[model samples]
Target chain A: MRSDLVDHVMTVFGAVVRGLVYSMLALPAILVVASSFTSSDTMSFPPTGLSLRWYKKAFDSEVFMSALWTSTYVAVLVSIIALAIGFAAAFAINRFSFRGKMFLQGLAFSPLIVPAVVLGIGLLQLFAWLDLTQTIYPLLLGHLVLAIPYVVRTVLASLSLHDQMLEQAAMNLRATPVQVIRRITLPLILPGLLSAAIFAFVTSFGNVTVSAFLTYGGNVTLPVQIFTYVNTSYDPVAAAVSTLMIIVTLAVILTVERLIGAERLA
Target chain B: MKQSVLNRRNVSVAVLLAPMVLLLTCFLVVPVLGLLRSSFLPGSEFLAGNGFSLTQYVRFFSDSYYSSVLMETFVDGLIVSVVCLVIGFPTGYSLARLSPSARRWRTMIVILPLTLSLVVVVFGWLIILGRNGLINSLFVRIGVFSSPKTLLFNRVAVTVVLVQQFLPFMILSVMSVVTQIHPVLEQAAANLRANRFATFRRVIVPLAMPGVLVGFNLVFVLSISAFITPRLIGGARVAMLGSLIYERIMSELNWPSGAAMAFVLFVSGLGFTAALNALAGSHLITKGRGNAL
Candidate 1:
């Protein structure tokens, strides 16, 4: 009877804990989405009445639109570059044993260990010294450094999981190494590659620390723009822009869930 | 003939490794080295000279204000990490015990916040924690407070947002280890007449320590270096290392001072990471011995 009471209490305790964790993670985003539809101009709770005026304002803002564009293209560019570089590195590290191979692996993974603020300041100073601060190249390269580590780590995880027997069997059938790789190896690791690309895109899109320093003139990314905008203004328009971000992030995450189970991310 | 084949293999390997090596060298390694070099330059000659000096370092160490910022960053990180552990461990334990489908739904809820832009997340918190925001309104409506209070732009608001920001990481880290712990361990403890609490205290807590340690370290490092949340939520009053570094560079144009602060932040982060590594290593050694016993 005592054990039964303990179990009952534990069960109730667990449920309450679960509910709290769930609400803490999900409620803020939901509130932002709800408040974006506020008819009132001021930032009020329970959001007054439901309307989309803030959404219209967010859409009409040129600064927000351009920042969104910059963020998109930069994210796309970062994914492609990081994927290409990480794939080659992963292939070498997995398939061949060579001198400095461990060093190569460490270098690829180093960015993950370094603080993003340090990287941001370093890149900012480096570009300023070179007079390249005005151009978008620093942003591209800074994000590339941040994104490449994820790509390499993901691709390496994928490569380790894949069966090498298929490549060996293909080679025994008189297939060239390149042919074996293209036909057997590539297809097997394609999911990892796709996962890596998606991870890179998400990281690059969500980045602000590194991008904050690299942004110059009118070249702010969406997060950086929103950050600066929020500092000055505290209205529903910020919520509107944030709601849009939440939507896009949700779409990407849902797609990733469909492609690869979310468990692998943990 | 053997040498020629070896040469060809080496060439292919070099080709495969070149791009990654070059990119890291040019962008990651060189830039950091450059920043370090600049930090050593005299603050007066930071923009122009190549001469090495430790004036920035001296000033940083000598000044209480700067050291206080650094100390606050670590203290905040420690507080948030502890808070996340107290709250997040149950969530992870729950996740590990759930059915696969239920875990999937819960995992999505956890991961969605991580994938969303930090700016968006902080903005949401701003609205909810502001003067006339949701929590205040609810409190006032319930007569808990006579009026709406300015809850945002303070340490509590900053800490709350950071806890939310990093809780998913802690939960996932703990979950990864907790799921590895077999159910029979707990069952055996129960069979030995240990109650559920005893089973948890003796069987579960020891096993979950490694994950908890890892999650704690990650949360510490991330929260320490986090710029946006503290800046947006903490406002101008609460100064952190990341924001101080930003001010020195962007607003102050004091590259040497900023670079020095960056290196200090990196070193402190490295210090915490090393401490965690030591903790994890000792835990493994003890666990191995216990198994043998």
Candidate 2:
């Protein structure tokens, strides 16, 4: 009986510690969202009366608005391009046993292993040498490289879990290869594809290191803009913008959870 | 007919691979090669001169300031990874022990910060750790302190923020492996007269080492290469190798020196990954994991 009590106490202690750790994990985002509603000019927590003035201010600013637009379009384009390439590579790797298959798979995932700072500087140097620094191509291409690995990983996971017998059955019914893929394969993997696109979108949207190097005049991304802003100033506008970013990210994550179940994502 | 079919299959495979191959080669391979080549050139002659030299490397090695930055970067990486492991192990273990529905909700909360941008998250830290911010005000109100302390722009703040940022990776890595360990083994250990702590230490921990190592290497690499967190939180008072490299390339326009330092950072990360793998060889506990790094 004494030992049972000891075990119970130990269990309670473990639960309390775990609770605190999880709270620490969630504390930063919570603080940022809370401070975004501060009524005062200075940023503070437990916020001196609630207000949305900072959100209005963030929307009113041309710099934040333009940067948001840039980030959105760039992320959309990157997600589409990454999906096309990642789908093809993942399909080929999953379906066919070609020579250099391992090489292709390794090369496809290699960007994840390389440090982002190196990739940033390398692209900056390459663009400067090619005299392409003035254009938006560097930012697009840099994010594309950073975003593709995630797309491949997600798509590959989706494809691997897919059943091949359905495709075989479709072929047995005199369906053409294209018809088999369109009618049988695509629908089965649509959840994975959507999730892969979301992964690509988030990776591209949240990027700062590579974008910092590649963003040319008048083309800064939202994250980079916020980074630069916070470096020099302490204000609630950053909090408002950060809250919006969190809301967008949370929405995407919820959509993914609805589509694929967040547990599977882990 | 068979030969023709084989040729068509080959052609289609090539077609599927062509775009990705082209993109990676043009943007990733060529640029990295150029960066490596330029690291051998002198800083002043980055654009004009083609001749190779070891001046940049010598400068990095011989200078105490640069070398200390590199050492500090590795030390910080070590501290973050260790702290992450200590905290993440229990959280992941408990998470693995949860019911399916409960685990799902808990995991979403755990990974919520990961979905948000690092800049946004760091801004949160800035608010909390700034003078007259959350902790300071609370402490002063309770008479724990006389005034708001200079909490931001220090190593402790940087370490705390980094641990917060990268803890999810370690948790997920541990949780994935822990879930795979059969419950029956724990039962069997208990049946053999072992206590809960004994079962955890002998059965669970050894089984979970592969995941622990993967999380360790991942957190270490990420923490060392981290740029924005250290720059924002550490400010000018603390310098990491990543910030130093950023300053050289972006601020000073010394491409060669920056490129060399970047290469050093990359190699050190790779070296540590290899060393960890070597240390955890193909034993029974690590056998089925298959090159997790």
Top of the candidates by DockQ? 1
Model 1, residue A125: C-alpha shift (Å): 0.7
The CAPRI category of model 2 is medium
lDDT tens readout by residue for model 1, B1-293: 99999999999999988998999999999989988898888854465867788888899999999888899899999999999998899899989988988888899999988888888888888778888888899999999999888897788889999999999999998998999999999999989988887688778888888898878888888899888998899989999998888888888888888898999999888987798789778977897578548
Scored against the native two-chain complex, candidate 2 gets a DockQ of: 0.67
Worst 10 residues of 2 chain B by lDDT: B284-293
Q: What is the TM-score of each candidate against the true structure?
A: 0.95, 0.95
lDDT of 2 by residue, B1-293 (tens): 99999998998889988989989989999888999998999755578857789989999999999889899999999999999998899898889889988887788888887767889999989888989689999999999989989999899899999999999889988999999999999999879877777677778888898899889988999899998998999999899999888988889988888999999999989998888777775563364354233
Model 2, which residues run further than 4 Å from truth? A1-13, B282-293
Candidate 2, residue A56: the lDDT equals: 98
What is every candidate's C-alpha DockQ against the true complex, given to 2 decimals? Answer: 0.71, 0.67
